[model samples]
Target: MAKGLCALLWLQKLMTELSHSHDHIKHIEVDCHFIKQNLDSRVIQFPFMKSEDQLVDILIKAYSTLDKLSMQDIYAPLKGMDGLKDEDHRNLIGGVVGEVQQHFPDASFMVFNFGDQESQSQIPELLSDMPVMNYPIHHGDCPILAMEIIHHFLRAADGWLSLDEHKNMLLVHCERGGWPVLAFMLAALLLYRKESNGEEETLHLIYNKAPSDLLRLISPLNPLPSQLRYLHYIATSNVHSEGCLRYKSLTLDSVILRFIPCLDAEVGCHLMFNISGRDPHNLTDKTPTVLFSAPERGKDIKQYKQADHKLVKVDIHCPVQGDVVLECMRVRAGLEHGETLFRVMFNTAYLLENNLMLGLDQMDVTWDRQNQYSRAFSAEITFLEMNPAAS
Candidate 1:
């Protein structure tokens, strides 16, 4: 009887161990099901690792050891500390500029925004060390000036920076306001480096070149007018200046025009004028009217297209110098009498600033219909040589 009783006690102990093992196995199965569901739903994507191809050397290989140690240090009193919790790297919530600086501490930053006081003020707050450049409120004004600023920075001082440039020009912006600017800026960069053919051509490359999912991430910011001019300028002069003023400009207006490859190689500019119409105000009967010599065609008398539309083609050739003193005979005739029309101040100065000295083909004056010059005055110009010719 005593032997039989001892045998029954051992059997009972074995049954209890089996029961505990069954419960532990069920718990593991439940955990595995959760993981499998997440995988099916794509909530969890396992990163592929080809390094060494060792199971023991996997990313989570150290997890088992370090995790246990880490768990031991976890405070039991903390809320929800009883179960295993999945973690990911997506928890990082930092500013873009800040994150970039974390990786490349010495990287230079230039923020392009709407230039409103509110938006610009945030830049210094985010990056205290970096400087700021405003795109200016150019409603109908030429945006080439703005585009030039961007093209200069991306290409560096010598205009040679590319995808593999010495210092990477990591483009970043906060929110979505600067999407249009970014689109133009990036397109210009790609064109400058010759990584792509033309603006629209390169823009397509930007769209198709990206990964499918990430490609959809871009905002369809329409190309700006200034950006279009950049394309034209690039296509025309291919002004790839490998000049010495390689360092970034200090201000938006501080473009190193001397760095244009063609201009940089020359002493200055050579100028030859082709004025189509005599400025109406200049009525000096005795004054010698100048004649414009067309390179392809012979000289023609400067006059209105049909004596109705007040349009004039000012085809200037820089055979010697980029600077040309434009004397609108019509305007001069207006000035000598009373010095009244401030048209010269507005029209002449702006025309020079926006479309002069960079080897432009011509400045076509769309004279003001109102006869005030300021009301309807506009100039359309082209580059001296397209990018192919310049190259």
Candidate 2:
């Protein structure tokens, strides 16, 4: 019973930490005070960072720095931070509050639409040293979109601040500045670090390294469906792929049927795909859509029926089936599946183009044994449209 009470207290503390309302003790403003008090009492020396320089900027409400900083110079004061220095530290940093932009003359904010563009004009007047890119992307597009904005800022400038030079840094914000902006900055930092080490800062590196939870937090605001889909690809590559398969079926009718081949493994997982809805003859309705993590052959699949099955369904429907694109990335695998690799065979009666199967055909399946929670796999399957009349 004593342990049970402790557990409850711990849970309550966690709940308090997660809460958003700032006015209540349940929200625990004292937590910060406690840290400060401990530092002052010599109980601990909490590294005190002024609001302007706090690395975890997402938690705070706002910040105003005296001058714009290059990415490298931004870390000058933070050099002694215990866990922050190494290239391996892919830790997320956010501005808890909207920052007061000051100094840089040409720096400004940009969003997806005209309204955002207009609002950003007001930002340049207050502070113009840094480009404050506020692209609230869908959880999926956050990283890539953030990269594009960063590159734009760099190319527009005379030169980029080297990580060692630390002359200037980018200060970015999203609604809360927690997940979307956090993921993008961390991933970009990692890429920047990799490039400094004489390694290429490729899309694969950023996508493979950034945490999945960070991407999920900002998925709703993605400007383009493709950006979100690319995120799905990255997350899938990072997770487990067991008994994962993709299928595409086209009918003379408007409906295109795609099936995920059932796995013998009793594993739980999420499968995401990029699907397009189009008319075979019209070529006008060729719009792409997304289907995220619908369950297949598992208990969650059963639960899907009790709730809204549509929430888990990754199907795309169109009036006619000119072409159907199917892709799958594995999110998790069950223990029942002893191995990480599995074969997928398409049993279609119709004839279709084989080159459409995979842009690349090599399937290298590997497990990150350190994370028993996931095993990653990549495979390619060809899709072709045979004569429906034969069926």
- The lDDT leader among the candidates is 1
Worst 10 residues of 1 by lDDT: 247-256
Query: Candidate 1: lDDT of 323?
Result: 15
TM-score of each: 0.31, 0.29
Q: Candidate 2, which segments miss by more than 4 Å at Cα?
A: 1-136, 139-166, 176-178, 192-391
lDDT of each: 0.34, 0.32
138-232: candidate 1 lDDT, tens digit per residue:
21122123333444555452232233233433332322233344445556655655555766666554434333333122222122323554555
RMSD of each: 22.5, 19.4
Which stretches of candidate 1 lie above 4 Å from their native place? 1-93, 98-114, 117-119, 129-151, 155-167, 174-177, 205-226, 242-391
Tens digit of per-residue lDDT, candidate 2, span 1-391: 2243356556546544545434554545667657545544678533433333433221111112311221222222234644244332212221211322333222332221111322333323323434444443322222233223433433322133333122244444333223433344333333333332211233334333334433433333231233333333333332122222232344322212132223324444445333333334443433323322234446553321212212233342322232233334434454222232221112121224442231112221122222322222223343335455532
Give each model's clash number.
23, 36
For candidate 2, give the lDDT: 0.32
